[model samples]
Target: MAFSELNLSTELVNAIPNSFASETQIQSLAIPAIVTQRDVLALAQTGSGKTLAYGLGIIERVHATGLQQALVLVPTRELAKQVVDALQPIAAELGHSITVICGGEDVEQQVQRLGDCPEIIVATPGRLLDMIRKQLIDTKRIDMLVLDEVDRLLDMGFWPDVQCIINDLVNRQQTLMFSATLPETLQAKVTKFLNNPLKVTANKINSVVEHIEEKLYLVNKGSKTNVLIKQISEQKWPQVLVFIGARDNADALCKKLNKAGIECEALHGNKDQAQREQVLLAFKQGKVKVLIATDVLARGIHVDALPVVINYELPSDPSVYVHRVGRTARAGKAGLALSLVCHGETAHLEAIRQLTKRALELNQLQEFPVTDKPSTGENKRPKRDKQANRRTNQKTRASQFKGKK
Candidate 1:
């Protein structure tokens, strides 16, 4: 569908490059409703163009009114960056400006940006509240408030920060919220913060992308790393993302993979903005072959034609599992999501199975040894062969005797 079909201003529509031609279901439906000045609650899978759906609404409204009147609260610094990057150009085309306020940056710079009176602010909840507390920004002028990834914001325990920001701006505004899943807590927040809202669900809550070819590898824990390496070596995937459960694991796994002659990078919570951006930018540009990350960096990331997503470690939340796989199969392209399941994680794998409601097809490893456990009577660390040991001892004795004589 064309951007002009949404009835946005011609300038706004033209500013959007041809890249956004194939609008996702969420955007196709929600964009028009949002542009009509309706408060929206959009339910769609990650990578479904929800960001641009609401971003266009925020930009169009602010442009028409010619005021600094929009605020978007996101869950992570990376997501905030993605939202701002997607919307800033369109806003610029309409002669509007956007200020990004998130953690891991110089606060003084944000303050300076606020002083310039940007037309829109794309921010993370914590840093937004921090700025508000310091009197660095004014909430009174905000006529449109958005909570992107509301479920994740609640998961991160940003309720107090979100509430504080909303209460401060309660006088009057339109509220738009988007999430992969809407739990009761977020529903309650909607009740308190939003007036009568229009709801739109572009996909079922438990839906998995059918375009992704899902595979599972049931390998023993000891050789899982080798199995992953073998899989990557066998295929010349242009860009691969591996999801580990912890930040330290992500770093260590990247090091191990790179040591095996596979160029890779790690992304997690600890990496500062510059490092994260560098790795992500390089990976997107195909300069890096693999990216190791935790679930924190997985959501709302847009990469073009990334064919492979490996779940090195599964996330506890099923919703996160959906998000991880959704990173691939994006923009109407076919992709692959492969999971490696060891013996100990059977129960966790079962949960994922129940969540997706589809039996995963297992793929056997390629001639790699599986170290399940020692045989019943066999020693884990057996003694060396007796003949070889005896020969070594005899040679040592002869040499000693010769020296003594």
Candidate 2:
């Protein structure tokens, strides 16, 4: 079905950007349910056009009337800004406007923008909760609550704030949830917040799109940078997004990549919102060839036709691996996810394989051989420090007990 057949307003349909094709799987299935004012829980991949699934619904129910009718809760400041940027143009065509509320920006400025009474408010939980405490926004006027990337919100430990916001919105009438991958444990908990929501899974949950090619390389921990630089130079990829494990690592790796003649920038929590936006714009616009980012960018930032995502360091939770590599192979385009695994890193690689449910092929770059042997999992006894050895054994046993639940 086309956008016109989704039952959206003719004006709204006509206003959709020419760049956006008529329909994506998520939009086709979730838009109709939302337009009818029914609560919906939608599951779709990161690059599968999930935003428009609920964006159109919010646009249909609101106009330039100026009372905030839709409230969208997201996981990060980047995502909050991204949601507004995606919907504002289409919304304005129908006489409605959208504003973003997030931390790392001037709260007074945000309050001033809210005074305009946009039809939709896109916000992160912490800042939104702060606004409520100051009585900046009238929750009574919001009727639709959208938990965008709901699973990531839970991953980031926002359930308490989310619940508080829901309770504060005494008059909220409908709820819409959308996520790429949700844990079964969390699914049961979040469902109670909705009213018999129509659950729509547009794609396999916790899985990558079919077109993505997964590659694994086992290397010495100290040789990862050499291998990464070699691969990028060999492939001549126009752009690549690299996920690291920490904010400091992102900055450090970015500097080294630039030193090696690759135009690179880092995105992480340490950067203010303005800086993050500038870095993302550069990466998307082709000004930056490689972007070193932390997991914060895994969920909601969209880069059109990006062809590669590299895991310089795998995430702590295997499920997050889904969102990290999702940066590429978006919008039906073929992409690549290259992972560099060192000796001790095999545990993380194994976790990713388990979550993806694929026997991902492991490779050795004949050029950069891995000389470090993989861990044997055996605890070697220190003959000189008998007491210390006993202490280590006790700690290991306790850890094993904890792992057994």
Top-scoring candidate (TM-score) = 2
All candidates' TM-scores?
Answer: 0.88, 0.92
Residues 1-405, model 2: lDDT tens digits: 789998877888899999887789999999888878889999988889898888988887774223358999999988888888899989887778788898998999999988888889999999999899889988898988999999888878898999999999998888999999987898998999999899999988888888889898888889999888888988999999999999998999988888899888999989887898899999989999999999989987889889999999878788888888888998889999999888787787788778778888779889898799878998777457888677667785555545434
Q: How many backbone clashes does candidate 1 have?
A: 0
The numbered model that scores best in lDDT is 2
Regions of candidate 1 where Cα sits further than 4 Å from its true position: 65-67, 184-189, 366-405
lDDT of 1 at 155: 81
Q: Candidate 1, 91: how far from true, in Å?
A: 1.2
What residue pairs are clashing in model 2? none
Worst 10 residues of 1 by lDDT: 396-405
